[model samples]
Target: MSTGKEELEVEEDFPVVDQDEVVEPPAEVAKTNLAKRRTIDALLAEKRLQKELEDYPYDL
Candidate 1:
């Protein structure tokens, strides 16, 4: 009887999770992430241009 009670308690302690309930990023979140990536890319490109100008000041 004690073992059965312990089993029931253990089962009740853990809630069941449904596989179908997945967490998805919102559209706004995706857009924000894209914008952030673009900003980072732009910054990197600007830095590269500065480095290139420093290396070849006479070319420009």
Candidate 2:
């Protein structure tokens, strides 16, 4: 009995995995970060408009 060939089959019922369990983040923390990103985007858009108004040569 010296055979070393082993075959194993693995099957999962629930294929979906929760990413948070592997690298968890608090709910409030994630929400706050999303809010901050939105605020930053708004500020960037405002600055872009200001630059366009100043740089564009228009006869008024």
Candidate 3:
């Protein structure tokens, strides 16, 4: 039971959609992302240390 209606064929419309396929980020993106994460981790660690230092003698 096949009516060969060309317009209904998926392959005909595939090329247009395929052309917009996602491309992986360039190497620089990985480097920058790593640096960004390191910077954030360092910042959070510093904040925690500062908060700890603030309660040196324990405000009891």
On TM-score, the candidate that comes out on top is 1
TM-score of each: 0.51, 0.48, 0.49
Error at 10, model 3, angstroms: 17
Error of 2 at 15 (Å): 42
lDDT of each: 0.82, 0.86, 0.82
Better TM-score candidate (1, 3): 1
lDDT digits (tens) for residues 1-60 of candidate 1: 355545343445787778788776766678898999999999999999999988885854
Comparing 1 and 2 by TM-score, which wins? 1
Candidate 3 lDDT over residue span 1-60, tens digit each? 668765663555544456469686766678898999999999999999999999799767
- Overall local distance difference test of candidate 3: 0.82
Output the lDDT of residue 44, model 2. Answer: 100
Q: After superposition, how far is residue 25 of candidate 1 from its true place, in Å?
A: 11
Residue-level lDDT for 55 in candidate 3? 73
In model 2, the worst 10-residue window by lDDT is 19-28
Off by over 4 Å in 3: 1-28, 58-60
Best by lDDT: 2
lDDT of candidate 2 at residue 14, scale 0 to 100: 78
Clashes of 3: 0
